[model samples]
Target: MPPQTREVVVQKNVPATMRDGTTLFSNVYRPAEGGPYPVLLTRLPYGKDIPSYTTFLDPVRADGSGYIVVVQDVRGRFASGGEFEPFASEYEDGHDTVEWAARLPGADGRVGMFGLSYYGKTQWQAAVTKPPSLLSMVPGITWGNHLNGAQMRGGAYELGTIYSWAVTTIAPDILFRRYRDDPQQLGRKLPELVAAIDTLQAGGGYDVLPLTKLPDPDGLTPFVREGFERGVDDGWWEQLNIDGRYGNVSAVTLHIGGWYDIFLGETLRQYAAMKEVAERRGTAPPRLLVGPWTHGNFGSTLGELDFGIGSSGILLNYRGDLADYHLRFFDATLKGREEALADRPPVEVFVMGENRWRGYEEWPPPGAREEVWHLSGGGSLTREAPSGEPDAYDYDPKDPVPTLGGSILMPQIYRAGARDQSPNEERPDVLCYTSRPLEHDYTVLGPVWVRLFAASSAPDTDFVARLVDVHPDGRAIGIADGIIRASARESYPEPGVISPTAPSPIKPGEVYEYRIDLWATGNTFRAGHRIRLEVTSSSFPRWDRNLNTGESGARSSRTEVAHQRIFHDPDHPSSLTLTTVEG
Candidate 1:
């Protein structure tokens, strides 16, 4: 840890003028006795004074560690001037803020950025502009593309997260700003909004029809409606998305993510893109750290499972805390004390089941072989191909499967991470294919996917694939999962590449091949543990339910019952592909 040799001073609501002359507010923290220290800036839509926003790194501590820290509210957010349209003004605003922060009273004109989630995204936006004074950044649990996994996944709306976040997290601020001057109006409307938020928090209101027209009577959150009305081909997403733009970022970066984070896929994509840029430019390669954590929870326990204390971000592998990791990287890059990071590895990942951290020179750890497990008759997953009768099930939109676990962002009631899948497996709609107990520890270290030859009786539908590790004690724990919308199957041409413009509806009752990307996972399936694959139609509320009517989910309330079939014949060998690493 850096020495706390200096006392810290703070200034609140400091204003910085943007290129458009709009003023944004920030809180500045600086050492009482210092001669122009390096500055660390974080811009976020969340309140600057909110403790939750600063959970990863404390600004006061950063200031005391011989640095000036500036935490700013993004435009249209708390204390900042301008209308709030998510991600629209981030690039320009972020660029302006970085330059302004560089010129702060105690700043040495060299700036580094740090924050989690949306704040992490702000760093990317600014870095893409190639801000002259920006030297380094650490973007944690953030996304590179907005549509791929941030807002929509597999061409299906992230209904649970989008609704809960907008209603509970974003609306309060919008309401506060709207009625700050009028107590009578605020009193009359605040309770109604609170009631709606409370309903959402308790896992209600998600079933409302015509998703685009949720109960926003005051029209406080127009973005929610716009998100639904806009098609994937619409140019609006370009303003917010960072796809194909990593080359524009010149700052050295450290990408941090969690196994169960909602944006894990895009986080990995961003790292790979930046790493490619670094290799081409002959600059230092970016670092990566992935833990067995969820969206904002960095603790050891997630869902029903408890990874050991070594997996905790606070005391990671008993080496240091997250703040220490950030400071050491900043010291190396911003202060030119390269020795501070000499022993750090380029890639550090927490391997679950093994419950230990592993260091690697690159991701996917080299020498991983692709292993195929075929889906066979008698509900078995085998190494050899199989010939069997197709399995069929009826899917009802009204009785969609509940969201149990995996990489999902929703209300606290719906926990995220590894959880028991026994309840879901019992449902008739879910098809389970199980492997016999493994004789040796099987380690999977890279991307996972499933290939299925199936037929549906509806014009459009959805297919979800989940990977599970079945314990000897009969516990079915979810590891990773993915979903694909039938009509929008062409959106994802490959594992990580997503072109969400085109949609081709499937022919009813005609067999079609579908590739379901389960993202990636790093786990050691211990001996005597069984590997299980689950195939289903919906993981409700996590991703919007497909109505099977070939219409937009946003504007339609109609429902349908679809009969789905899974084939496993010699010619149509449905299988699961796993990237395995040998000991």
Candidate 2:
């Protein structure tokens, strides 16, 4: 660390005009004495001055780190002009903003972008435009596909997330837009809106059937409803997929993610795709950093368990703050300095249970072996398949499996990461298979998958698979989980459908193989610990329950109970595959 050598200057509400003649506003921070310096930009819908908007890095610290920092309000936000249509105006508007920042008075013609979540998304959108001055970007906990990871995961709607976010975060802006001119009317309506959002967050109003109709009579968040109305995944949603256009990006990227992040799956995909693109172009490979954290909190404790003192990113094994590390990274990429990352590894991850950070030259860390554990009789999880009959369970949409905790982006009422699964496991609808206590310490540090041969009485149903670690005292903590709707079983982007709008129906007694992606995990199960897997039909609130009807979406009010049979016989061996890391 060094002392400040130059006077700090601040400029407020600087306007940048887009190609469409709409003006977006920003606040610039710079060193008054410096002739020119690399510019750092953050574009977001949240107000530029909102200090608590992101947990990743601070703009004031970034400005003090000897760079010109520009924080802008994206189109249709606080100080900007234009109607806000999420993901529609970002590409062109972001491109125009980056180019504008490059020409700022203290800017050195090299531009770098940084932020997390929605701001992270803006960086990816901007990069696709291929601005020559944009040098590097650091995107934290963002998605590769809007339809898949951001909006829905494994063909399940993010019900609680969409509802909470739309009401609490986006509705206020919408209200302001509708009543900006009438102060008296706006004051009168704002309290009613606040009360409505409060009721929704407090857990009473979420049970509203037919998701398209919310706010009682009419929908307040039209965008949230629009997502539900889209029956088929097409190129329309793919237009927001940054991973598909990675070849067009020339900037070196640093992808930072959390182990318990809702976007972890997509974040890893983005890093891998960018790495391939960099290799093809003969440029520096993309770097990845993952820590034990939720969407907002990055600390030793999440939910009920405290990992350890070393788990916090700020105090990570005596390393300096994460913000300082990011400053060093920018120094290397934007200023061409070699002191920061001269000996740094390409990938850094925190292993839970062990509570230690490990660095690797590549993702998956090489030499990881895939081991399959079959679902056997007597609720046993073993390497050998059973010779008996299949296990059957009844799933009622009226009473779906309650979501406990594990990588959720819903309301704060449902905390994320590593909570006890006893409440959920107690339900008869959830079938559990537990492994005997391991004789040796086993490390699983990569992607986890569950392959199931199942049949549903209903034409359309849902399948959920969860991976858990069972402690000696009988605590089952959820590690990771995934879901697959029967309609989207055959393929992704374009699912197998009987008609253009409706998904194909499953024969009542026929068996079909389903793959459930549990995403990636970095954990070390101790010798005394037991590995557990739970099979169920739904994770309510986190994902909307399938009403067991041959309908396109949850818009249908008709519901039916589904009889689900999971086959584990020799003919159809259902198994859980773990990526084991061997030293």
**Which candidate number maximizes TM-score?**
1
Model 1 clashing residue pairs (backbone): none
**Which ranges in model 1 have alpha carbons more than 4 Å from their true place?**
1-5
Residue range with the least summed lDDT across 10 consecutive positions in model 2: 493-502
| C-alpha lDDT of candidate 1 relative to the true structure | 0.89
lDDT of 1 by residue, 1-583 (tens): 9754667788999999999999999999888995689999999888998876566888887876779999999999999999998888989999999999999887899999999888999999999998999999999999878777777887888888888888888888999899999989999899989998888778888887688868874778889988977766667887788887899998999999998999888788888998899999999999999999999989999898999998998998898999989999999999999999888888999888888899889887878888999999999999988778999898998999999978888888899999999999999999999999999999988889889889999999999999999999999999999888888778775678788666799999998888888888889999999999999999988988899988887889998999999999998999999999875
Give per-residue lDDT, candidate 2, residue 196: 73
Worst 10 residues of 1 by lDDT: 2-11
Candidate 2 clashes between residue pairs 3 or more apart in a chain or in different chains: none
lDDT of 2 by residue, 473-555 (tens): 88998888888888777544222111123356678778999888888888988889999999999987888888888774547
- The global C-alpha lDDT for each of the candidates, from Candidate 1 onward, is 0.89, 0.82
Instruction: State the number of backbone clashes in model 1.
Output: 0
